[model samples]
Each structure stands twice: as structure tokens, then as C-alpha cells.
Target: MTQTVGSRALSSPRELTRVADRSSFIYLERCIVHRDANAITAEDAEGTTHIPAATIGTLLLGPGTRITHQAMSVLGECGAAVAWVGENAVRYYAGGRALTRSSALAEAQAVAWANQRTRLDVARAMYRLRFPDEDPSGLTRRGLLGREGDRVKDCYRKNSERTGVRWRKRQYVPGDFTAGDTVNQAITAAAQCMYGITHAVVAALGCSPALGFVHSGHELSFVLDVADLYKTEIGIPLAFDIAAESDEDPGPRTRRALRDRIHQLGLLDRCVTDIKSLLLPSGTQASEITVADSDIDRVSLQSDHDQLLPSGTNYGDEAGW
Candidate 1:
């Protein structure tokens, strides 16, 4: 049977490429993106590039990019996230879906977030992950923030010394990308890319992006939290390197450099593992998790007995009628 785009069968969670295996993200600008069967075709002045829809963790649509409805439909079916971003990824507009059918991770995140003690514990855990030598258990949220600021300052200083880039304060004016110096511009670009990548991983894991432990009041607060974990280690150094080279097109160069580094380091896999470990119970191995174990298309009804009932069955006594 011949099926139209609308009538085509969707790929199950197991059938789609795992988050770890997929490219962290594909950043496209000045191109028209449309679906050709299961592949995405990006048409630009250079040429058309064919991309497998299922192998994408996120489709980052930058400035001047237009996408068709069919492309969006296929991306959604494959559980690939789509994010609309600004040039140099400085502005993040909107995003797409959660990749899991099970509510396990989302429920776990809520449970941890809903309580003050557990929430603090999670925040401390995050800090510990970011700064292994530092103990965050005794610190209040304010103290944690202070420690983080101190470390970031040190990181900036060290990177400046390492890269020979002029040491200056991190200057970023919202809505103005050109306000900062070359280094600052690169830093902003790297940070934004990290956010986009982490957002995709968070969504793919089916966790709530709003329920954050450290960062608060934003829809992508949790995403920001996760992305910061790698900022000092990955983003700062890369940004410094980019700034050290030349001032020409810092945004694009930073994105390209960051993308290569992320793929080389397999940051996507580590991101998945880290998020799962943080949200899941203690002693749980995040690496062992898989979408198939969660069972795509599996649905159940909650009952009073603390058990799940099979869905799609009539519960009435006169069922045969």
C-alpha cells in the first residue's frame, strides 16, 4: 500500500536512533528544509544536503531558515526535537517534544523537585558534578551561587591566560550580540549552543524543562542547569580558542568548533547519562536506560489499588451489550 506523508507509519521509540547515537544537533540557516520520504533535504545556495530524520537529536533552525510542515511532521514522528534559534544561537525561541512514552523520568523529576530537602540535594548533586573537588552539601543556594560565580571568574581568567585573549569582564547585553568583545561573543555563542543541545537531551529523556533545582522562573530553567555543568569545561575553553584565532565571524566559527568538540567527546551520551542519574533513584545506572524498556505506545490507566489497568477495555458490568 502506498502511503502519503500524513498516513505513513510513525517510527517507534526503539526503532528511532538513540539520543547518544544521534548527532547532538544540526544547525541550519539560510536554507529551506523539507522532507523527502524519511530524509530531510536542506536546500541552500550551495547545494541540497540529505539528512536522516531519525539520526538527529535536534534540528536547530537558525536565522533565515524555513521548514515545511512535512519536515516537522517527520521530525516529530522520529522524536527529534526542533528548536528555532537566532544567529550564533544567541536567542532561543521555541522547541519541540519529549521523546519517551513512559512518564518515569518526569515523575522522578517532580518527586525530587516538589520537596525542599530533595530539591536541595539534587542541586548539591549538580554542583558536585560540575565541581568535583568542591563540597556543596554544606552550602546554601546563595552560597552555591557565590561559589559558582567565583569558579567561573577563575575559569575566564585562566582561559584568557591560556588563550592570550585580553582579560575582561564577561559582558553580554541581551538582544545585542555585537555588544560584547570577540571572546565574549564566542562565549555567548558556545553557551547558547550548549543550551540547545541540553534542551534536546532533556526533552528526549521526557523530563520537565521548567522544574529546576538551582535555576528558576523560566521554562528552560532545568535545561540551563544541565548546560552549565559543561560550560566551564567545554564552552569556556572553546570560546577562548575561537577568540584567540580571529574576530571574523566568531559566531559561526564558535558553533562549528563547539559542534566538532561535542561530537568528539561524545557529550550527548554523557548528557543523557548525567540527566538520568540525577533524576533517577540513587544507585541506578543511567547508561542502562533505553526507550524500548519504556515501551513506546504503551498506555495504561491508574487504579485505586496502586496498580495500572490495561487501557481500551470497558469497565462496565454489562460489557457485552
Candidate 2:
């Protein structure tokens, strides 16, 4: 939707065609990305390097990268995905805003989530979309969970056999967080990459990461929902392949392997398409904007408390949600 600064819509998404290089880049060195006059620049011990703010797709920040608030705002406006990584592995910790100004997707998400039947239907659709070969019909949420878990185990076993990396039962030492085992560490690394990509896509579509259909309670629950779709397909293979190499430490190797896989599969584009397809069903347009005239006036008049009656309802206010 086209918009102006004066419009009620808070922001407008930038043109996706503006994506430069057609590829994303990672910043591993300690550098600061900040606004410099008309452009964004990254400065480090070596020297100051200019960032092509308008063209790049996702700008990944590994350890030791510092980004200014202004730079983040610039990236948001540019419709570029910016990700902050975890301490040990390149785990996705947080992300910047989406390019979209429209609230259509978010509102649609809320409406679907608020309705139990619709939410389950959407969940079923998600499962079917992710696993096209599998049948998800007539399955309850718990049933879906059980099936999904079985599929995951199957994937681990299948990949282990293919890669010849003795698939031990999936286990992790929780208190350490740093995976003691190579397979666990590889899995952790791969999952975070998927999360990073999924988070970027979620932001691009202007959906809320906190509101999820299957998974809930935690923030980035929606992100987890979307990323889980590719977990078996992407994460499992990548982790096992890396672990098969007996690569001493799976953290860095997993990051490299996952990045390559993400690029090769064009996972980001797939993510965008999957989100829109799942959220916005075929032949159905997002709702039309029909903000009431009274609603608009109420916002403009709410600033003056004295204009309202003592009961707190505006003197003659009848129009509200």
C-alpha cells in the first residue's frame, strides 16, 4: 500500500526490488555500523568501510559487531533484515523492525489466533504446507505434535544414516548451554540460523513474532512456528553433515554449513513465499481499510482531558471500538 508521512499508517515498507547484490553478507569482525551523513558505514580498527544500505538483503551481525540505533532505523527503512547473534554459536537473539507500514498482517494474525477453530485450521494448514507429503487431516493439536515429534526423530535418524554420524539419542546438557556433544552443538547452530532467517522473513511480512498458532507463551513463538517447518529439511541435514566430518567443534563449522545451505536453497525467498501463502490464503485479499470517521476524530480529540465528562467517557463520545 502506498502511504505518506501524514497517513495514519506508522510506516511503509520499502520496495523489495531495491535488494542489492542479491545476496546477504556477514560481519564477523568488531565493527560499528552507524549513520554517516547520507550513507551507512561500518568502522573498525582497520578502517571505515561503507555499507551498501539500500541493496543488501540480510546483514548478519556475529560477535563483536556494534550497530547504532540510527543505523538500525536506516536498515528498517531500507527493508533490510538485521540480526544480532548469540554469544557462542550464531544463535539468533533479536532483530530489527519490518519494512511494512501496514498492520493488515498483524491484525489478521490476531483475529486468527483469537478464534480457536480458525487457529487450529491455520495450524493444520501450516503443517500441511510444511510437510506436503504428509496428511494432517482430522488430527488434533496433540496429534499433530506427536506426529511432528516422530517426524523429527525420523529425520535425525535418517540424516545420521546418510551422513554416517552415529545418531545418538538427541540430548543436551542444559545447564552448560554450550552443547557438550558435537551433534547437539551442530543442531544448536543450525537451528539458530534457521531462526535468524525465519525472524527476518517474519519481520518482512510485518507479523508478530510473539503471537504463535502452535507454539505460545514465549516471545518469538511465531518465529519458532515458522522455523520448525524447515527444521527437518534444513537443520537436520546441515547438522549431521557437519557432525559427520568429526570437525572437533561443530559451532563455527555448523554456521558456515548452514549459511551455505541457506544461500543455496534461497531459503529467505522461500520463507517470504511460505509466510504469505500460509497467512493470506488464495483468492483472498487482506481486509480493506475502513476506519470510521468518528474513530479518527476521537484520536484527535483525546488529547484534551477537560473536554471529557467526569465519568471519563468523552462528553458526547458514542463511537469507539
Q: TM-score for all predictions?
A: 0.90, 0.78
**Poorest stretch of ten by lDDT in candidate 2:** 289-298
Query: Per-residue alpha-carbon lDDT of model 1 for 1-321, expressed as tens digits?
Result: 333433335566665637888888788889999998887889999998888787888788888999999999878877788878776545555566667666778888999999999999999999999999998878998999999999999999999999899977989988889999999999999998888888888888888889999999999999999999999999999999999999989999998998899999999989988888888888766544453554547678787667788999887774453
lDDT of 2 by residue, 1-321 (tens): 332212223222334432222354354547888865434677888897765465455677766888888887777666667776655565555565655555666767788888998888888988887688988989999999998888888888888789888877877664454655778888977776667767767776678998898899989889999999888888888888888898676877887777777789877777766766667646654333112212122222323554533343454545552
What lDDT does each candidate get?
A: 0.85, 0.69
After superposition of all CA atoms, the RMSD between model 1 and the true structure is: 4.3
CA lDDT for candidate 1? 0.85
The list of candidate 1 runs beyond 4 A from truth reads 1-11, 285-291, 294-296, 314-321
**Counted clashes in each candidate structure:** 0, 3
lDDT of 2: 0.69
